[model samples]
Target: MKSMTGYGRSSFLCENVEVSVEVSSVNKRNLETVVSLPRDWQALEREILTLTKEVVSRGRINFSVKARVDKAERPEASWDEKRLRDDLEQLRIFAEAEGIPYHPDASLLCRLASGQKFEQSLPDPTKMTEGLKQAAQEALKAMIQTRIEEGKHLEADIKARNAEITCLVNELEVSSEGISALWREKLLERLRQAELELDAEDERVLREVALFAERCDVSEELTRLRSHGELMNQILEEDGPVGRKLEFALQEISRELNTVASKSPSTEVKRLVIEARAECEKIREQALNVE
Candidate 1:
């Protein structure tokens, strides 16, 4: 058992690039991965998605990769000498025409050229790709570890709930005989209150009541429920993804609980059935996070 909600991040440093990868996920019915990479690294997106699918069976997963080149490897800013010279020539001519004073000092020229000066550097695609792949693999491994830890917790909770439900089932069985006796006594009291006397009819009434008791019996449901619980435990203990299988099994358990609830006759039996159903619902909700 493993939870689908988790996040992990990793960073890789190559020759002149630092790459960071982050993976986050949430519960989903099917496997879906969305990757975000630099435009230059778009070709790697499909490969990354395929790798994720091989590792993570099911989830709404988001993978993000960010890369930055080392500052030392980046080009240094330099003055655009031609553009600055042209601008200064035009400025001097305009000053003379307008009869305004113009100081063509080194500081002024540098200030004027600042806007046009810029560094043009492109990151190495090969280095970035290698770093990104390493970061992504590390992040994926961390995410899977987190999910496995959470799965252990969920498995323990579901197991405890299954135990409680089984205990309740046993209690219901123990009280069933008492419930039948009470029903018979109640029926007799009602008949007596109605001033109905049927010496030959009493036997038939008892026989019908016994049959009704059998029809409303929950022994079969309890048996099946226990069996399902065992199977769920077995699946949880296995080595791979079992979310879909566990979910389907939980649905079956819910169906059985509903049947037991509907067939319940005595108030005590109804209450027990409701308790069992509540446990089943909890397990079902937990199953949604399994993987």
Candidate 2:
């Protein structure tokens, strides 16, 4: 079991360049990863996204990569002086021919030369790509570890709550027997108060009450609830994503509890059913965060 929220950061030193990657995640219905990298390293975005998917199954993950290269290692921005001068002369001639006043300045030429028209060679793409990918993988691994650790705590808490629910189910079972006896006594008292005589003809009425009691009985529900609890525990203990399965189990348990509550004639039994439903609801909420 693992949570969908966590953070991890890692830094790698490659030659004279230092690369740092930070990966953070939040709970989401699906795996959505956004990568923020320097323009020079944008070509590696797809690789980083793939690496994230490999490491994480679900979440809104944000990955940021920052690189600081030593001055000697940095790619210097340069311009083609000859090309700049020729373009400037051509521009001046064109303006003059069009009868427009042309103000050719050195600063303007310099700016034009520094634009995209000029070639700015970047660091080795292969090395940078490999380094960035490695750093991202490390960071993602760390983030997953953090999420797994957090999941341990969540799993324990859920298990404890499940145990409490089981205990409540047992208590309800014990209380149910007493509730049935009390209902029988109360029904007899009401009959006597009505001046009803105990006769062989009254057997039908007694049998009817017994049938009603059987219909209202929640023993089957309790049994199914226990089975569901065991399945839930097994799912949580398994070695992969089980949130959806747990959620399905929760729905089944809720449905059974609803049936029990609706059929219950005794106020005590209804109250116990409600309590069980509440616990199941809590478990459902927690299951939403599982992955």
- Predicted structure with the largest lDDT when compared to the true one: 2
Clashing pairs in 1: none
Q: What C-alpha lDDT, on a 0 to 100 scale, does residue 235 get in candidate 1?
A: 83
Report the C-alpha lDDT of model 1 over 1-291, residue by residue, as the tens digit: 688988899997765566788999899999999998765568878778877977899899999887666556756677668878888999999999999999899889767654443113435565466666677888999999899889899989988988888788787777665665667777777777899864535787779679878877878888898888789778888888998888888888888878877876777777887898899889888989988
Which number leads on TM-score? 1
287, model 1: CA deviation in Å? Answer: 1.6
Q: Cα RMSDs of all predictions?
A: 10.4, 8.4
lDDT of 2 by residue, 193-285 (tens): 899866534776678667878887888988998999999899998987777888899999889888877877767778888888788888888
Off by over 4 Å in 1: 76-127, 200-203
